[model samples]
Target: MRLRQLLLAITLVFTVAISPIQTDAILAEDMAIIVEVEGDPNKWKAYIEDYHPFVEVIHVYDTLLNALALKGKSKDLYDIDKEDFVRTIHPAQKYEVPNAAHSPSPIKPPKRNVNTPYTGKGVKVGVIDTGMDYSHPDLKRNYKGGYDVVDFDDQPMETLPTEGMPTLHGTHVSGIIAANGEMKGVAPNADLYAYRALGPGGVGSSVGIVAALEKAVEDGMDIINLSLGNSVNSPDWPTSIAVNKAIEMGVAVVIANGNAGPDNWTVASPATSVKALSVGASITEIKIPYLTIPLEDRKLPLQMLVGSPEWNFSKPYQLVNGGLGKEALPDVQGKIVIFKRGEIPFSEKVQVAEKAGAVGVIIYNNEEGVFQGGLTETTSIPVAAMTKEDGEWLLQKGKEKWAYTSYQLVKDKLAPFSSKGPVVANWDIKPEIIAPGVEIASTVPGGYQELQGTSMASPYVAGVLALIKEAHPDWGPNKLKAAVLSTAKPFKNETGSLYQPIEQGMGAIQTEKSINPEILIYESRLTFGKINEGVKEKKVDIVVENRSEETKKFRFDYPHHESGVVWDIPQTFYVKPKEKKHITVGLRVNSRKLEKGLHQGWLTLYNGNDEVYLPYLFVNETADYPKIDGVELTLSPFEQDKFKYSMYLPDGAEQLTIDLYEPESLRYVKTIVEDEEVKPGMHEGIINRGEFVENSYLVFVKIRNGKTYDSFVTEFQNFPLQP
Candidate 1:
């Protein structure tokens, strides 16, 4: 389904649609918001009835954290915010499944060779997501009961049958944790409880998620795997704060780092919660050996790209160019048809070739680099993509009587889409660890299929944590997290360039090493907050607890390439058995010489054959952005044809611009304000919309200063201005 339809479905599930208001008077916009009201529940209910009678309360929390999910008009929110009893009012954010892909055996437990066989036998893992297909062959045995927060029913799997169904997402996540049929999950024997927080399109509001989390805790789950999140990077965001509370209550929360990657400061909220074990995606490399295509006089080995349908043919076929379409194709009957990329979709081209009786289809890139492509619909023929150069070579050598060519799985590496971090608000190195996520084959709704993204990676870790929890039932979430972080195997990309700590964290999971270690670090990472030009040094204490039977001697080393910062570590140290030792690590920064953004390095502790790594991250505060604060936008309360906005701009704001856009199509409508000098403190303006088109528009307020830009968008619906 399209995003619009999906959003509509979510809206229908939450609130009933209302007709547009018919007067010059402003209408209230319906929205999902979290309200933290002070005083007793009875008083709050009285206040809601007395003033905000139109509000619909969703969930009420009365424990350590008191919050309520209320569906009300936007104006009611403003009135509620003004009341003294309201602590904070925030719009509930929506989260979706980050889309993953396949190797399992290589990263499985047997390959890691753990000392004890751990199948997560008794662990209760709560998959707080879209809902699971409990009856799926692989998940049935381990399926325990769960609740559906969306439908307010007990059966979480009651999902609407549609394209891009949410059931597949949750099922795939569950399979990654405990599927034990055709494929094996990280913890095949772990018990699973499905919580259908998200509906049809894998779209769910923070309100539903929080309720689901509460249900998980109440269900006595040992681990909660949240393979869903939104791009709210703030640590104190309601959902994120709740996640921390869950951790405080003794549940190990594992969340996806998100797939909004290849960019910095994109790690989503909840995952940004310091207590949650955030996971990033990594690609499992499958090496295909050179295929020997037998020529009349010689057997030449050609490295060819593997095709989908992923089948091996018994004999070789003649090669032909299928051109851009079927009409341009030569008789490709029982032949391997080569097609150039462009003009049409990759799948369509393959389908056309398949109709032309081609035994296999090869799509070559229009540009450089070999791409991995697939057919949208299943075809009897095999298909694959190759580089433009390879296609050209094959075309030129068509005269050669080619016979057949063959391929193997070699190694794996990190996926490029895995989000990078040093999380926006707090420069903490995220995605604490990486796992198999690229094209991962896991259980879908009914059977099995491959899915990809950090969604897959999160469960991989959650499954691994299940094992860790089973082996060390007494360990707290922190120790379990540290075990995973410290034991992760460092990795480099295909180019041999080492992935930054922010991108891959401590690296891929080493499940075997994570099970038991002689020494345990109190924290997986450290942050040296805001280093300014005048700050000379910062010191932090790292506590090491030796869990071994014998005393251990350790040597420490810091990153050699890190300059402008000096790391002071003890050359040698000793920790008594079963005792904790605190070591002070000092960082002297030459702030004047250091680069502006976030800088990071790792400190390694070596004890004989074992090594533990602690990552340190710090931001240079000398370089800062123009601060935009207290931004507020309101449609005219009286005139109904005007937009009023106010904001506080601190520091040098070179220019400020306000543009109007049609939210549906995201098309630029007109500029309300442009290229104006914005000064500090409260600034307000009125945009008269008497001349603009009478359609709903999104107003964007943007401020630019030097190289920094800050902007905010608000919706404005203009019902044909009253005659």
Candidate 2:
């Protein structure tokens, strides 16, 4: 009897131990989804009501793409997915604000002059973002009408400030377009419509954005600005498709290029829409005074860029050199420490100094240019960077009498956080234009606040587009896009090298030149796909249209690079009045001599005093790196009941290997597949959860294509355990 009782107790304990995991799996329902249904909308609504009452229909699109946004339990999703009329269903993805900086004077178009008639007077622009503060002095005058997709209301202005800073992002974006108070917007007189798709904390789903777009079109908005996007860079994504449709309906759309910067293939979704204007961030040359050190009769100004300028300290402090160690130095305590940039990461060096009781840290560059660095942990002290020259000068001065120093701003440059792109799969140059997005002052909930990101840059272009639309009310979206892109000023880094076309597109928008341009190009930029090593040359044509009434003579000029990439263009050409001419530009690249990366250059067309720029870019292809695509990884349940992964291999792949590892410890777990030959097509595999002991693991897929090898790594966590 006792033995039987013990066995029963063991069974009960086992069931108790696994119940939480099982419950968690059951509770993990699909709350957000987009569904496409066929036939009548009323029938679909009735079907949803009868079969899936728990599911809430958020949006219904009857025109263009037949779709509906529904939130419900996972089982209902499965049932709906199996319905005959249901075309496609996927989770409503989340998109974020890429975030912005300054105003109109940077681009010379609207000119901030009372006499300039193009102030976006008659155009209506729809801003789909966090709700706008309709009461703000600058935005109130231009507030037209909008809808709140989140709350399903007509009043789109933020209503819940007690929750947080309401309407922060939308207000800032609206201010950039039509703010007419203490700060002037790019187009002060444009009509503004606020679509509150994003909620508190600037978070919203793709369904809400789609609803906003549909409503914006229905309201007869001339242009729509989406300063938000996700990191998915496929043109076929739902948001991208919706953006294309909006363009098809004659409304121009502008989206942020995302803030996932300094890396390629980081341009966000919808921004990846070929028809939309993707704007990147650029820094303006606005100087902010930091410090002034007393030196005899004259004060020496020490201007530097602070990593976290929000953390400030003003009292004068002593200086010491805190070498790359946490070891105590008596002089460093209660003083500012100067460190050289080497031997360790900048954040680590600052951390070591902070541990040694340093009040602040100044890291000097090992190279020619100045940089901004930070500590991983938030410190009460200030930290900044100086150029190699400045650092050496400061070190020399430190040896003599104590030197006092303060901070000040220097010339504006590109924000380091601005996302770079040519976009993966297909190399499409993104960030069609750059605008001032660093430390820009714009409208906020209560007053003006300084924020920075590609988000700020996008609205700047939108405002500029409003002006262009006002000036040329009859121009199509493509013509407006071409005018802005062709007239932008190319930007070169401080080192005097032109930024890659993928980085800056056609460069900064030249509003003055874009408006009333003598000529307009059909395409914004030309993209020459991967140039194989043995391929000698390729050709493409750009059509130039003469808008002026008189015959015009033009001179073609292009900058040459040492990358073995050359462009052949006629030095001079002529176009008759109101005529179009195709200019064939030949691209020649010696791939054998060139490095395997994106190569770019500009071809400038000059018509007397007016000039337009076009950018050309190509990726030099080589077998040194394996090419892989269409990668998908998923886990069933929560703790690992099953694992499924699929990916496509290029033609040359000889072997493929898949391995699992413990990411935190970097410990090898198991090899699911090894030394397996893979053909150039969709390959998929599944594994049971029993094979993996840990709840979290990093899956690495390595491919050997010809003589080259490349690997892709992704992480899976909380997979369900097998019974």
> In model 2, which runs have C-alpha deviations exceeding 4 angstroms?
1-32, 38-43, 71-79, 87-94, 98-115, 149-167, 205-211, 232-237, 263-265, 288-409, 558-568, 622-657, 663-667, 672-691, 714-716, 719-723
lDDT of 1 by residue, 636-698 (tens): 332356544555454426888878888888999888776566665446666675645745677
What residue runs in model 1 are displaced by over 4 Å at the alpha carbon?
1-59, 63-88, 98-115, 162-166, 180-183, 287-410, 495-497, 561-563, 621-657, 661-701, 705-723
Scored against the true structure, residue 63 in model 2 reaches a CA lDDT of 56
The digit string of per-residue lDDT tens for model 2 on 160-273 reads: 657653447788888888887666788999999999988865777666788788889888899899988875656556688889999999999999888767666667677988
Model 1 residue 342 lDDT?
84
How does each model score on lDDT? 0.69, 0.70
TM-score of 2: 0.76
Q: Please estimate how well model 2 matches the true structure, expressed as its whole-model Cα lDDT.
A: 0.70
